[model samples]
Target: MRAAVVGAGPAGMVAADRLASGGAEVVVLEATGAVGGRTRSVLLGPGHRLDTGASWLAGFYSEALAYCSGLAMLRRDVTGTPQLVVGGRRYPAPFEPGVLARSPLLGPTEKLRFARWVAGVLARRRRPHVGPPRRADADRADRIDADTAIREAVGAAAAEYVLRPAFETMVFADLADLSAAFVEGWIRAAFDGRYRVPAEGMDAPWRRLAARLEVRCGVEVTEVRPQGPGGGVVVEPVGTFDAAVVAVPAPVAARIVPPGVPGRPAWLGELRHAPHVLAYAARPHPDPPPASDVHPAGAGRHRVGSVALYPGGDGRVPVGMQGATVSAEGWWSDELLAAGLDDRALAAALWDEGRRLEPGLFGLEEATVLHVARHPHAVPVFGPGHLARLAAWSPCPPVALAGDWTCYPCVEGAVRSGRRAAEVLLTAGR
Candidate 1:
């Protein structure tokens, strides 16, 4: 059987791999010059490369971890005690009960309320599964926004200072813009395992996977149509295939996919995405450079969302110089994009915000901007009723859809979506 996979991101690449493993001829078409879609890593300097896209690999990313098993993986030591900055104060924000008891980020009463809420969510937590969540999982929480649920359960201070920053850093969207069901799932999944990154780079695994496949880069697929009953054709560089998988972002998929495709969602074009801006910088470090990552929220006039530090020991930096990637808040990133600032100016702005958030640590007066990455569709926002909509959607034989937007917004979601899409095609072909 012949298959075509569009968009060489994690989902597309994984689908191609699965199709090939099933003894099918597969061709992957990527619009960009590179593979690894949002997991892209770029050169920092002479002998350094930094991940400007998805950086950390959670313990729950089973598929991604298995795909990169041949490469050397380094356990990230910074996950143990991350710091959260709120109201110009820094507090240790680990998941430990003792740590939360002593933390001044929330009052005693608020902490009690937050703890009860967390316990309730955990008590009702279900086992981890792939694909979209079932409709049976929907409840009153699924109908409300995360911000409202959190604030009501655990006062405004706890919501703003503790929960909001941590979740926002993960999804790149404000709590008010997300569904309570999505946040609850993330809460249940949080701290399940340690965090790690590839010694080569975050994209190392995808690059290895791509090297073994037939990938055509710099090729834009204009249209995908069902040729007959169980066959499809790709328009640009037209070719007939037994099956085709559209693995790009939802907005792009909506534009390329013609009408009358089976199992296509009516609201595919209405999906929303959060914009992201990341600025990479390098400079000589002071003795014992900032070891803790900084997450700032609910602080007025703070544009920077988080500052992730690379302390040179990892392959992420040269010796004696610390590397850091500063990301702007989702809302602020939209504003930055609208302002139309040049790359240098944008990098400077992000760096300045990082320095202000951590004056003692990010005091790199002479830091050099390595690169700036801007993603217009960084992550899919799972607002109220979004998950239920996905639960009811499924792929057909000739044409299938696969992406993180089809599931949760993470590497795991992308991997699962690709595998599911390939399984559907393989089954139909048989």
Candidate 2:
């Protein structure tokens, strides 16, 4: 059987690999010049590299980890245990060790309150069902899942410690739009306390997956029409396939697939997209400490010693890996600038601080910065009631859907969704 996997992101790549390995002829199509979708890397210099898209991977990302391990992707510890800065005070991260070790933001009572709330949530994994208590017919027609805000569940203290920072970095939007159940699940996974990054960036693993499949880059799939007779998909530029899996982002998928297929699986219209900016810089010295020593009044704690950077020469630093959060209105640039960060200045400061965070850190020199691209809607918001929407958008035979946005918007979720889509296809003997 011939299968066409649309989109070159993690979900699409995984599905393509699985289908090919399962003895079906698979053709992977990507709109961009390269694969990896939102997890791609950009050339900073001749040999320098920066991940222009998806940056971090944690052990909590089970599906992603498994896929990477299967592909033999190497990883290094990039996780930093940092002090949380709120308002104008420094406190330990919401975790127990960080909370008890030190913090000026939380009083003893507040810390305990935060800890207690986390303990309670960690003690339970039975995700709370959202919307109408019971699943209504409309719920199945629509995607339905757990619905709760992290703030409401963790309370203000924990929310301030954990949810706030995560929401800041991940959601890059207001907490009102994020899903409580998804956030809770991640916190529980982190309770195991391990986060790591691939030594060669996320692209390495995707590249490995690509090695196992036939990927066509720069292929724009305008639309997918169901071939009248058999269970097949007519793909532009690629003719027809006995079966096809639509793995592109929601907006892209909406444009390709028709609304309802009656007898065929159809994805609901365009899922929402979030705007994001990814930029990189190279410098001659380590980035300097924030102009202010106080957490809030001075430099932002989120930057220094937090972003990922390569260690090497003349106190030069790279500013791309810091992974600063950009809000809807680009408010993050102000936060970064106030913290003494700019493309060139930030890189120089990192070099001054040393390549690493420890005392006497080494820095790079005028490392060449290649380029950066902004994914207007990179990570999808797993908002409250998203699960219901997911169910409502279920697919039919010969047509499957997969991507990070299809599940929880993360690498693991993307991989899992792809695996699930593949499983569905395989079970149906496609």
Q: C-alpha displacement of 376 in model 2, angstroms?
A: 1.9
Query: For model 2, how does the per-residue alpha-carbon lDDT over 203-287 read when each residue is reduced to its tens digit?
Result: 7778888887889998999887777657588888778888788887777777787766432334345356665543444444344
Query: Against the true structure, candidate 2 has what lDDT?
Result: 0.58
lDDT of 1 by residue, 1-430 (tens): 8999998988999999999999989999999999989988887677688877887787878898898898988787434555888767888773567888988887889888988988888877664444456663556677899989998998898777778777787677888999888888887777464678887888888888899999999999988878775446655565778789989988888889876888678988899889899888777765446455788856343577788777766666877778787888888899988889998888878878888887654544567646889988899998988887888887776778999999778888888889889989999888
The most accurate candidate by TM-score is 1
| TM-scores of the candidates in the order shown | 0.93, 0.74
Clashes of 2: 41
Q: Which stretches of candidate 2 lie over 4 Å from their true place?
A: 70-82, 86-91, 97-101, 126-162, 229-231, 262-267, 286-367, 388-394
Give the residue spans of candidate 1 off by over 4 A.
Answer: 77-79, 126-131, 135-139, 286-288, 299-302, 361-365
lDDT of each: 0.81, 0.58
Report residue 11 deviation for candidate 1 (angstroms).
0.4
Model 2 worst lDDT run, 10 consecutive residues: 290-299
